[model samples]
Target: MSVSLRVLDDGAWVSVNDSRQVSVSELWRLDAPEFCSCTVPDFVVENFQSVGVDGRTITANVYGQCIQCGETGVPGWIPVGRLKNGEYVDLDRENVVLPAHDGHEN
Candidate 1:
């Protein structure tokens, strides 16, 4: 049983395969953190906000549509924010980093 995250943007689906780990509780928390109030997942999103002072999980709405194809369910934890140049900023910053591609194929 493999599930994936699908973000709906610009009438198209974007794959957020950041490690491909799925949890039902985590998704529920992200959709409505105030109502659910679950611990924030160990990932970085652009529009993560803290509604409460306790400061655990983020209480922000993911402002995109589901992009995962074939009904794999809603994509989990998409940080909502203003992105520059219509390009996505990578949220994964763990371990030693690799050089970002400058649109030049090697």
Candidate 2:
């Protein structure tokens, strides 16, 4: 299946299949040690640098701040959602701890 992914509204939202799906300004719990010194950072999503798909998972290069440590930068590729049956399924970003992966990883 083909999915159209885009960073929309000047990096405020992620457009999937021409529709706005994931968005910025949401607080996400991140398991990203590389992003900050905190074991789990309370991340505030500031922008969507880019978006892509890895298998069925939708990932984004996100620019955000760690509310706990005040660290700011792209925390690598963070999973935002998933593609299932040609439709977009939103991840529980606000409630769950999402793992941030290095860009080189599969």
Candidate 3:
């Protein structure tokens, strides 16, 4: 099954499959060193810049500043929330796996 997500209330809520699976405040807790090429301790997500569905995974383009270097903007997509078997998980950041970026696109 495909998954869809949307940013509501200006990142206040992330509607996954027409249900709120995660919130902006909770995004702050997500941190994956392999996702971005930055050395920041964590990506402080303040807003949801965009959202898209990729196969069975729901991707989210988050806009936030780096907690360490202060770099701001959407670094890339992160899978914070998910919906599997019609069950909602409270927190699921471990499954966030970013595709290898070899400094090439397309």
Candidate 4:
């Protein structure tokens, strides 16, 4: 299956197929070691790119920063959505990298 994704709410929301899926206004464990020191729950998405879906799983590489450290160009993924109910599964829990990210569900 195919899915669509985009930034909403001024880079605060990930709109999956035109629907809001995740919010960046919340706190998250940003896994970008090259640009974050999120050892204290202090990160926010500054930007995103390359959003699309592989199979039924959504994928999008992300760019963010540490709110405390003031870093940028942090690489990650934007979780567009997940599959369930039919051989159900959560895409965010998968071990495959779609550029980067683990659902960015802060």
TM-score of 1: 0.21
- lDDT computed for candidate 3: 0.57
Top TM-score prediction, candidate number: 2
**What RMSD, rounded to one decimal, does every model reach?**
15.7, 1.7, 4.9, 6.4
Clashes of 1: 4
The better candidate by lDDT, 1 or 4, is 4
Off by over 4 Å in 1: 1-32, 35-77, 80-82, 93-106
Worst 10 residues of 1 by lDDT: 49-58
- Candidate 2 positional error at 77, Å: 0.5
Instruction: Write model 2 residue lDDT over 19-94, tens digit each, in one string.
Output: 9998889999998988899999999999998998888999999998999989999998999999889999999999
TM-score of each: 0.21, 0.95, 0.64, 0.53
- The prediction achieving the highest lDDT against the true structure is 2
Clashes of each: 4, 0, 0, 3
> Which scores greater on TM-score, model 1 or model 3?
3
lDDT of each: 0.25, 0.90, 0.57, 0.53
Residue 7, model 4: Cα distance from true site in angstroms:
3.0
Task: Give the C-alpha miss distance for residue 21 in model 3, angstroms.
Answer: 1.8
Colliding pairs, model 1: 6-67, 6-68, 7-67, 8-65
By TM-score rank, best first, the candidates go 2, 3, 4, 1
